[model samples]
Target: MTDLDDPGLLDDVHPRAVLAELFARQVRADPRAVAVQHAGKELTRGELDDWSDTIAADLQAVGVRPGHLVGLAVERGPVAIVAVLGLIKAGAGYLALDPDLPRRRQRALISAAAPVALIVQDHLDRLPTHHLPTVWADEAGLGDAARPEAPPPDDDGSRVFHVVSTSGTTGSPRAVRIGYGAVLNRLRWMWTDHPFPTGAAVLIHKSYGLVASPWEMLGGLLQGIRSVSLRRDELLDPVLLTDAVLDRRVTHLYLTPQLITGLLDELDGRTSAAPDIALVTSGADTLPVDLVHRFRRRLPGATLLNLYGATETASNTAAFDTARLAEDAVTVPVGRPVAGAELSVRDRHLRPVPIGVRGEVCVAGPPLALGYLGDAPDSAERFVRMPDGSVLHRTGDVGRWSADRQLEIIGRLDNQVKVRGYRVVLEDVEAAIAEAPNVTAAGVHAAPPAGDTVLIACVAGTKDLEIAALRAYLRERLPDYMVPSRVHRVAALPANSAGKLDRTRLADLAADAERPVAARTLTPRGPLQSALATCWEELLGRGPAEAEEDFLDAGGHSVLVVRLIGRLEKATGVDLPLREVLENPTFGGIATALQRRAAR
Candidate 1:
């Protein structure tokens, strides 16, 4: 068994120091170090400190006080970073609101968080118009005025540092209140266990609304390391992101599995020199073993670490370094509990299960977040008091200790769905599909209720995959009931703003594919129609597709549409508008639009 009771490791974490204090210490240590870089601009530690201090003073002057919640709806950049620091220095916790999310959802989150004031980027029109007192972050501290002399508010590490919302995949998003003590412990453990070089840079490209974003944005700054911030559009473009990492000399990266997979694909077969990345941490979703192998092969010099935890646990409780994984390793273990954290697998009754027995993964210790904000019942239910006086947060994730004592996550307890009459674990099916030839990633979801709920599988691969062969491959391993009844090919699985797999969107797509649509017997007439039909058939894995068939009904999603558009543009040399193609999704509509443009 692996022993995690290390007194030295526990003693390293400063119990009283909060994030604000730690950042202040870094500023004092090296004021000239570059703290944040975004788009061609950079902010030195001293500049960031003064700007945030001035903003903090401005916030304090407008009735913002310690323990107050302030809403931050700013685009990703230096301004957002400064706003976060400013709020922390003012002794107020921030509620991050992503500018890309729907205005209704943003308003809903703001209402739920009930922040006293809002900090927004004035140029972003997507931000909702809130009635709260507003502070324009972009213009707050841009002037060369004198820095404030007032010191930051005192913090004992018990105050709420931030309030972030859950992914809301299963239901409405829950606001989680994370205290400074929890975040401080997590940061301390990360710095101690995986310390980066002095001038190393980290990327902060994740949506600010996510619970995981703060670690990316603040982790490097607190240690006096440069953090490169990318806009959402830049983050979506793999080539641009790779260029940024290589150009900015990013040595460390914390990304979701989905995002990392895309980056690895972009980096594959490149002749350019690989970036000097020292560490790449994967979290926010399950890290696939295939991805681990790919990372080992593609960038053998860098170490890949799989971190496991949730929003309630301040992002990660345990981490596994995939440095010396065996060639035949099937699943990646989430590793032992980090310093200042205790992890145990428990049964339904919350009793500790025997080693190697699959059960719910429960976390205890200082790294655990306070609880869900504004929901006392949920807080009490998830954050249960143990008989030993330690508060244990039940992670709904199902996992077990391996023979070597590392935690191996099986799947979510809630992911067990009823297919026909038999119960099926989606992750199990996804694993089998992912092992198939050419397949890189896979997602399995059960279709919504009808007469009978059927299982659907979505697979993304380097090459085209045959559904019949995939089903046959699954039949050899999975049981009859476990085999997915329907399969869809996608360029990549969809991810939410948080970078986690959007399972809700996947299920909706699967359900839409299952819905029968009337097929019109329309054949290709012109060159445009012929090209459109060919591309559609190739993308959807159905040849000789009718022009009148709805693209979405034939298992075509936005990702696939983008690929289809690329193929059509290459084939005909006519510039096609993405919005036009999406608005008129049918092959006939697209072909007509293309013909009209060509005629002009």
Candidate 2:
């Protein structure tokens, strides 16, 4: 066996070398550059350093310390940035929670993370059930919570900050421990290969915008570069995003494919403030060539790069730079591995496959993960492996090296499906669905059919495309069994924080649509509350859901509303909108609304 600790190999590059030291070096070298921007406001590097120091001091006040995980659950703004820097300055990892996630989902994440404290925006107050100490992300008092005068460290004390969270899949999120090694190496790679001009203003607009913007910021922050943080919610208006970028003199705009698509749709003739950003990067999901072409045509000044990577894999594993997107290689190639990263195809045995052979792509590099939280070092072998001398990471992604050594991602092994005597790749099926005219994103889910598997496809289509035509088009690419039994043509697919189609929530939506379940009027139960309980029983079906449960969260929607209101009107003899039923959904709220209508 080859020496597992071979010194010559790239895998030997220490993961610890990736983080803290670089951040400290950067800070010391330059402390006066603007570090963050929120809603057009700028915070300089020195200000950010001082601010982060204060925030870190505040975190210590709240009992958070080095090596602890701080839950960063807040909207994308100055507060989120400060909280992140604070946690990292304290030498802790942060679990990012977006404000847009459904409360139940956020609660599940909090449970999984089990953070020492959750730093949140003030508007979000319903998170107590998860029952963790809450640190407000933007506490004005934290400004004075500075670190005390200290003697110099014996060593060059510096730390690379890492943002950690669970995979977008596997339901509830948890803390995925990230050492600076992975984070810094990835940034260093970006700087070496995709260098941007110093002092360029970069606008970060992606969902995990903080994490995604690392490439631009890590490079920019040290060189007096400006980073702009536009609120994702505010940018729901595409014009606002464009305006924000142009107004802020944004020179590098990193956004997800969805946001780019939204901006394209909203923009007709285009006004001023078309961001002067010279380089725009987007990824985390497939960037359709059509969209890529559209972006290229629209943004003539920028170099559009399709970046593909995951949270654990140091944010970006590969990138496909597009000079002209439709140049035969329209599909984004995760590009050549950055410096300190190694890429090779491997078989199931973890042996390296021959060049150009398709197998699971294994990455052996300096930037490998430190492993998940609470997981054993042995557990690292599951993804970070020592199978063939050098430690290699087995990315579930199926890919092969080209003649040029550029990787071509086939799909994920987890996405592979074996139908009745036939193997099917869901990515292949998704590609077929996207073949339908006007379909941008396609999600396919399977349910068990009698003696066979059933396929259901949810596609995002424009109004111009008919479902029948889409169905007909899909029939050409997919076989009969593979053809979807139900094809939903919605405005767009529901994407989670990462801008990739959320398969779990899509599965839930599919189940909800299929089952057609309705909500029942549930009241707080007590012997003394008999009259309210009786009203609930008579007005709707079953027991009361908790106060936190919304009509929609309880799996009730408009179709279910039709049945519910029919039943409610018959029992309570009061008509209410499907909206009213959902708004004041509880038995008490519904009853009170009915009583008001009666009095009127």
Q: Compute each candidate's TM-score over C-alphas.
A: 0.74, 0.63
Q: Residues 293-381, candidate 2: write the lDDT tens digits.
A: 77777777778887766545666777778763445764566677764677778899877887789898777766556555554343465
In the order shown, what is each candidate's alpha-carbon RMSD? 11.3, 14.9
C-alpha root-mean-square deviation, candidate 1: 11.3
Q: Report the CA-based lDDT of candidate 1 relative to the real structure.
A: 0.73
Please tell me which predicted candidate would have the highest lDDT against the true structure: 1
The superposed Cα distance between candidate 2 and the true structure at residue 502, in angstroms, equals 21
lDDT of 1 by residue, 1-600 (tens): 101133532342333235666687778888888888887887888888888877787778778887788888887778888888888777788887766545655676787888998887768745566677777677555655335434344555567778876533222346788876776677768877887676798888776666667778787887778898886545644556778888888899886665676678778737576788889997655567888998888888899998877778887888898986778989889898885788999999999999889999999987788888785445787899988888999878889998889999886766755442233557656766777888988887876432235567888887667765776576544444566656777778878999967998987766565444223345778788778777876665454346665565455544456567767877898767667887887777888889988888
lDDT for 583 in candidate 2 is 73
Clash pairs, candidate 1, are none
Report the Cα lDDT for residue 360, model 1: 93
| Positional deviation of residue 200's Cα in model 2 after best superposition, in angstroms | 1.1
Off by over 4 Å in 2: 1-34, 102-112, 129-134, 142-145, 148-163, 167-175, 207-219, 265-268, 271-274, 324-326, 375-381, 387-389, 416-600
lDDT of 1 at 95: 85
Error of 1 at 129 (Å): 5.3
Error of 1 at 76 (Å): 1.6
